[model samples]
Target: MSALLDQPLLWLVVTLGAYRLGLWLRDRTGAHPLAQPVLVAIVLVATLVVLTDVDYASYADDTALITFVLGPATVALAVPLHRQLARLRGFVLPLLTAVTAGAVVSVTAAVGLVRLLGGDELLARSMAPKATTTPVAIAVSDTLGGLPPLTAAVTITAGILGAVAGPSVLSLLRIHDHRARGLAVGSASHGIGTGRMIVDHPVEGAFSGLAMGLTALATSLVAPLLVALML
Candidate 1:
């Protein structure tokens, strides 16, 4: 059992299986608000690791394979974006304006919440880019002298929450425009929310891709500057 668990592939299998189980449960529960698959998967995997006495480092080493796919997945979003180039070109100014606002707001809100909750500088910085996708958020956190692993975890949590509850919130606010909904979700929730928007509508998908890319670029630049200024 020990030898089998020691294999790198074991972690890959375990993580995937846990995620599938999480998804199954979420579906079974009719997509309950608190039954977020990623969140559930994390709990499941963490419990398993604790029960088996497996080190986080060993688990992370194998999970890097899954993390590495995020880059390609982000790039794949460009296909729908390309098809909607003309529409994007039309509203460039408003999109840029909104993306800029979202970037700054995301950073401030996350950092502010952490500080309000009595977190220190490192924790604040780690949460600073929570609205961005995992890859970019990790990089931004590292640049801001934050813990990359912690940032990755926070970013994923934010994404999962946004993907699950964002639409309802938007509907409550009477935001029915597909483009507006997509941009809002993508800017604040990153890739996961963007993926959901893509399944809902093409315009939403395009705007989401645009918002995600632009917000990532903006956040990458803005976060470091903000941290430096505050420091």
Candidate 2:
């Protein structure tokens, strides 16, 4: 019953099972962009949480193990990056410029759109870091006097959107350069998009992992200054 639903182990199993189902669906669907495994898993987990009436706070706490694993997972992206170190060095200057520009544009567009839509300053601030990774976005939102949890949700949504449609969009634009594509996706979508790139294209994923880290640093510096001016 309620007590059974509260077990951390049960939730962990449920989370993994949901992801497994998502993977199966993705394979069955021929790996369509819309069939993204994480997106599917999110949908499945959300449905289950609502059905079980489990509060988000308890669910998150119960699933803390997964959160801890994310740190190492992020660090592991370095393996592929290390393999690209030689090429990375040659592109350092351009990559830095691209990431910084992307960070500025992302913050400006998010904050501007929110304000234009009549959202208050608090909401606009919360939306400012939506393009960055979750932890960085949450921290930036908190520091800007906005709600961290709201920023986290928005950040994840943004990431999912980028992962689902970014590659196709690049293809449409005739952007075939893997480096450029990776930089664009990682700068705009953070870890989730980078994860997609990692699975679909290894070289792109290496550059994407590089961009994700750089975007975090760039956003951290750019957000405060940019938001201050806009607000």
Candidate 3:
């Protein structure tokens, strides 16, 4: 068993297997929100990690290939966006405004809520980038003198919440446009929400991809200034 723990391939297989189980569970549950594949996989993997006392760094290294795929996947989103370029052209200004406003609101609301709830400044800083993609959020948290791991956890949580509840909330508000739904989820939840949007519709996927990238850039620029103000 100890020897298995030392084998990087063991962890790689475990990660994939866990995700496959998540998919099976999702299918069995009729694609219920609580059974979201990524969320389920996260829970399973984390539980295993805790139970087996796996070193996080080793586990991450073992799963490096999975992480590497995110780059090409993100770039591939542009293909769909390109197909819808003419339609997207008319919304450029509005999209930009939405991204900027979302960035400001995300940072301030996360930090403010944390502080208001009696969390420390460090925690507030970590939460500041919770609305961005995991990589961007981690980077921003480090720059703000917060814990990268905490920021990553918070970012993923935010994404999962958005992916789970975003559509329902949009429906409640009578937002039926795919573009608007995509932009709203992508800006608020980043990659995970974009992934959910892509699975729902191609047009929504394209807009979500665009919004995810723009939100990351906007947050990267906006978070520093906002944190400075808080300090």
Show where candidate 1 strays beyond 4 Å: 22-36
Model 3 earns a TM-score of: 0.94
What is the per-residue lDDT of model 3 for residues 1-231, given as tens digits with 9 covering 90 to 100? 899899878888988898899879877987676777788889988999999998899999999999999889888888988987887768989999999999999999988898989999989988999888898999999999999999998889999999889988998999999999999999988888887788778888889989999999999999999999985
lDDT score at residue 119, model 1, on the 0-100 scale: 86
What tens digits encode model 1's per-residue C-alpha lDDT throughout 136-216?
898889889899999988888888888789888999999998878989999988887786677568988888888988989
Best by lDDT: 2
The C-alpha TM-scores of every prediction are 0.87, 0.97, 0.94
Model 1 lDDT, full chain set: 0.85
Give each prediction's root-mean-square deviation over alpha carbons.
Answer: 2.4, 1.1, 1.5
When 1 and 2 are scored with lDDT, the better candidate is 2
lDDT of 3 at 94: 94
Q: Go through the candidates in order and give each one's C-alpha lDDT.
A: 0.85, 0.90, 0.89
Any idea what lDDT model 2 has? 0.90
| lDDT ranking from best candidate downward | 2, 3, 1
Best by TM-score: 2
Clashing pairs in 2: none
Q: In candidate 3, how many Å is residue 122 off?
A: 0.9
